[model samples]
Structure formats: C-alpha cells, structure tokens
Target: MVMTNFLQKRKSVRDFKNKEIARDSIEAIKNYIEEIEKETETVSFKFYENGSIIYNGLKGKAGYSGVMIEAPSYIALMKKDEEKESCLNTGYYLEKLNTQIVNLDLDSCWITLDNVDDETKKNLFGAEGTKVDYVVAFGYGVGKKLFTPETTSGRYTMDQIVFKDEIGNEISADELETTGLLDIFASVRFAPSHKNSQPWRFVMEDHNVVLYMEKSDEDSRSLVDMGVVMFYFEEMAKTIGRYGKWSVILEDQDKYLKVAKFSM
Candidate 1:
C-alpha cells in the first residue's frame, strides 16, 4: 500500500523549469548511474550533462509525437543488442533509475526515439547512440500551473488483468485479498508503461504469479513495458515480505505471451 501510494502520486512532468541541475546533484546522478548500471549489464546508461545538445538535436525529431520534453539534463538507455530480454531489462532498470531520480527531489519523463534513425542517433549521441532506444528527460518542474487542468491516465483493476491459473479464467478479488496479495496487485498496477497502455496480465497458479504481456499491434515496446512492471511488482512484493527473482519466460501463446514467472 505504501508503494502504491508512492506510485499513485508519481507523474511525468512535461513542463520543467528552465534551470540546470546543481553541480553536486549532477555528480550524484552520475554516481547513481554507476551504482545502477552494475546490477544489469544488458542495459547501458549514458548521462548527457549538457542537455542542450541532446534537446536541440532531438527536438521536433523524436519523443511521443514531435514534441520533446525540454529538461536541463537527460539519460539515455542503450541495449546490448536487439534481444527481447535486453528490451525487458532496459525497462526494468530505467524504472529503477527513475525511482532514484524521484528520490532526489527531481522529475522525469520517458522519451522514446522510435521516429529517429540510426545515423541521426550516432551523430547526436556518439557511436553508442545508435543503440539507444529510450532517453529520459529529468529536471525540476516549472511548478503546478494555475488555471490549468492536469490530465492523467486511467489504470485497470485486478479482475481485468489478473486471471485464475491461466490466461482466460477469472481470478476473484476475494482470492487475491485472502492470498495476502491484494496490496501487491493494487500497487503494481500503477507501474508506468508506454502511452499508459499497461498491456500486462498475471496468471496466479499454485501461489506463484506468472507474468504475461498482451501483444499490442500498435506498440513495439511492449517487452520494455513488461520489464517495467516486473520491477514494481517485485518492489511492492518485498514490502509485504514476499521475495523472488524473476525467471524470464518469453514464450508466446494463442491469447497472451508468457513473459516471466515469480515463484514466491
């Protein structure tokens, strides 16, 4: 529930103050990146100290449509290769790093470089820039705007996502609460995904939770979304004294694709 509350309050800041992060804070972020990178070698993070170059080059080029979130600094995620596992790991660790960014009293938003080409990426970010799929824009917010109504996305409930033993069977709310997993599910549902698609499901069988990703014909980054949810689920589970390492099982089925399993 505590984790859920933290997630519920977590929002992407599209409007940031036109200010650079402090020198100490920048060093702290670089140090955090080093600390975060060691845990997952498949995904590499690069810090853009002067975001002007990145923001200038990527402006009107990448991001959700053509608008890029202008921030004082940026962080790019590069996968080792074009592997599904690498995509998942990229999502997982990106969220992990974002958590730290939030903890430091900063704001961040995930930006996809889908529309950008490899040649442009290399020119903008150096040779390894070609491998970058996602970059995060993080900085201090311009503060809440007055006379401006904020827009937020909606999340699905357990009955819509959690299934009983398999993909199609329905899992009741009573079963989830009795199993002491009600809070875990409630919290993890808030995990951020691409366009807030939240294309993930759970098949709980024999007290173990099996993760599945609903194939989206429109989004190619669903595997990355899978990894993002896995991080939050494990995090919320630990607060309730549940612990398990995810064993990735990316096998596709007729209805849903099996992503991973947690035997807790």
Candidate 2:
C-alpha cells in the first residue's frame, strides 16, 4: 500500500483497543527502518507508549493517557545532523517506512510539531541540532469516529492546488480524472507537507519525471518534503504494481530541482 491509499484508509485513530502490538510487526518495522538507514543514512527510530501514541504535542494536546502508558508504542523518526538535506530525506524515507506499516494492515496518522510531548522528546530524539521534524501515530483502531465533515472537506483536491504546468496554471478537476497521470499524481496531492506547503512540482520530460523545488521551497532537511512526495508516487506505482527506481536530477533553470524520474 502507498501512503495515499494508506491515507485514504488512515483516520485519526483516537480510540484504540488495549491490544499489544504483534512481535513480528514490530520486527518488520525495525527491519524496514534499518534498511532505509542503510540506504539513506539519516533515519533513526524511537518507541513511545508501546505503540499507542506514536506522536504527541499538537499544541499541547498529547492525547496519550500515559506518558509512556498511553498508546501501545510510538516511533519517533530523527535525521542525523551530518546529512546535507536531512529534513527532506527524513520525510521521504519515513513515508516509505510508513506505507509498509499500512501494507502490514496497521493504521497511523502524521503529526506536526504541535502534537508531541516536549518532555520526552529530548530523550526520544536529541535536544540539540538533531531535530525531530515529523512524527506519526500508529496502532489498532478502537472503532471510534474517524472524521467530521469539516475534516474530510479540508483535504485539497488536484485542481484546488496542483497545476498542469505551474502554480497559476490550474488544471481542471474533471480533466484530471481522465488523464492517466491522476492515479500517480493524485497520490502526491495527498502526501503530507510541512504546514501544508505542498512544496513540490513535477516536470514530465518524455518518460522521465523531473522533480523541481520552487524558489520559496527550502529543503531544510535535505529533500524531506520531496521525499514524502516521492513516497506517494512510488506507492501509487506499486498499487498498479508498477516497478521503477528514483534518482536526483538537475535542470538548468532558475528553480532548484530534486528530480526522481521513473522507468518501467
């Protein structure tokens, strides 16, 4: 499952059953993190609440009942200080780990700086230069009310934000449906961004997918935001069972680029 399908399946799992996480799932998650770390060399994992409250702090709303007792357990993703684009790398790599969790049939929701507990954060991650850019909460659902009309309505559509070319050149919602790119691109629309900036763009050069970072976009953590978007496209390809590899490409234009062209 890709992150969007997982996102479609994902709900704010507020009420959770008191079930313990399976050992195999735990190992799988750890192993997945290890694999990513080996490849990207920036991801680190930490557990909280035994898988119940993965992230807490959304403006001091640490939902977990126990400091360590609230949820089953939580995983905190951190980027190493040495990595050049650590934050962006963290987002991209973590989403890959996240999607796999969904493929395993688990549920989770991403959290920003506001929803986590600062007290334990320093211990879970580091207090200095090592920043915990993003957090995700995962666990078994308790059959609780997932979303309100306001929440679902808030999700931005392709037309509302995405463009056929650039930010101003808006593409019609109806037109997007008929295009073959929708299934893959629509998933990018759902990929999480810091403060919902949606700081990503795609340039299709024949069979290549050129990723561009608009001027305002700052890859504070290396291409972490771009990584999140890449994760969406990767998962979408897999949903259709499409196989491909990604790489960094450069364009001789005014804008900064983080290209990940796919090949069949």
Candidate 3:
C-alpha cells in the first residue's frame, strides 16, 4: 500500500495474534526506522517480543489490558536532545514513520503515560539527556477488524474540534466540504492527543491552517502534542494530493502561540 493509503487504513489495534512478526517485516521496520532517523536526528527505535523484559513492567499494572495485552511485538520509540520542542518533534516525525508501518499491513497503538515498561524502555534505549515521551505497540492483530475504541470511546466531530475564526464560531462539516477544507481537518480530528484531550483548534483562512493551543497549559509536553497534530495535517494533505509546507512562526516571547500555514 502507498503511504497515504496506509494512513487512511491505519487505526489503533489492541488485539494481536501470539505469533511474532516476520523477520522480513522486522527488517523492513528497522530499515524504515534507519531512514527516518537519518532525516529526523532526534528519534530512534528498538523492537522487542511480547514476553521480553521490555514488556514486563506493566504486566500487573491496572488498566493495561485491551490491545496492550496482546501486542506480540513492541517498538520502543526513543528520542534524544533538548532545547526547542524536542519531544513534540519526536512524536511528529515518528508517527509519520508509523503511518508507513500501516502500509506494511501491521497494527499499532500509541502508548502515552500508560502500559509503558519505563525501566526496560530506558535500558533498551539507554537514556541520554532526553526523555522517553511514549511508545507504540506494533504487531499483526488477530482478526481483520480489531474494534477501534473510536466507536464506543466517542470522538469529537469537525464542528466540535475545529473553528473558523474563534472558539465559538464553529466550521460546520457541510461548510467544510464546500470550502474543500474537510480533507485536511478530518485527519487532524483523528490525531491522538494526551489521553484524548484533543486540545487543538484550527483557524482556517484562505489556504492557510493556523494551529493554536487552547488548553490551560502550553508547556513542553503540549508542544509535543502540537508536533503530533502537525504531522497529521501534513500527511493528510499529501494523502489527498494537496501538498503544503509547515514552519514554526514565533509570534510572542512566550513561544506558546504558533502559526503553521499551508501554501500551494
């Protein structure tokens, strides 16, 4: 499958077969990781089996069942370097690579603050000055459809998640289609947030999509979330054959409010 096709087909998978991923598949993952690592200097990855020490930390931890229990293979996404928005960049670029993994017919789930074997992760990656923001569990799921939580878990619609100019001024789904903005925003709506907080808002003007942080906090971690959403927008745009460029526009001394516009 093509990368964009993979992005469209990919969803979080928690149920998996007990069998290990194929050696060729593992090699494929490693090669892809190497290529991405070269482009994005901050990120690296390590793979492990389900029973290995890497996956043992959360064995007895509460609320770790569901998809996490059955991930026969694990990919530990690691990043190094500080200063600037490093963790956010880690999530952004690593997820782009994960999208490619979907094209390979594998399953993945992003682990943020839950079901993580911290010590084992650190040992495997060997912590530097950097922090392990999160990990993604990957493998071949058991059945065709693994029942994504989006159905029962609930998700925000385009109107609720995105705005045209202000928080109260919602961009209706119908209006979005008329404006041809739905394709990009659709992907942003599906991008994962911290515990599904979805603390992002969009201001669509002309062809530019300006990202603004709306939550109570704009700390380092939030920048990581920003990076995640940025990746989603770029990938979604490319998937739909609308290519755009992104850059961080420093607006204030605080460095919280960011502007990432799209240009034809």
The prediction achieving the highest lDDT against the true structure is 1
Give lDDT tens digits, candidate 1, residues 34-152: 98887888988989988888999998897655887789999999889878899889888999889888878888888888889888899987888889988999899876631122444
Clashing pairs in 1: none
Pairwise TM-score winner, candidates 2 and 3? 3
Candidate numbers, best lDDT first, in rank order: 1, 3, 2
Which residue window of length 10 is worst by lDDT in model 3?
61-70
- CA displacement after TM-score superposition, residue 10 of candidate 2 (Å): 3.4
Quantify all predictions' global Cα lDDT against the true fold: 0.83, 0.60, 0.63
Which wins on lDDT, candidate 2 or candidate 3?
A: 3
Where model 2 places Cα greater than 4 Å from the true spot, the runs are 1-4, 48-69, 82-84, 113-120, 125-130, 143-150, 154-179, 214-223, 239-242, 249-264
Q: For model 1, what is the alpha-carbon lDDT of residue 197?
A: 85
lDDT by residue (tens digit), candidate 2, 143-247: 654543345545566665455544446666575555456666765665556555666776544445556665453546336777777777766667665667666
Q: Mind giving the per-residue lDDT tens digits that candidate 3 earns over 168-228?
A: 5767788778766676666556566665666666776666666766544545555667777
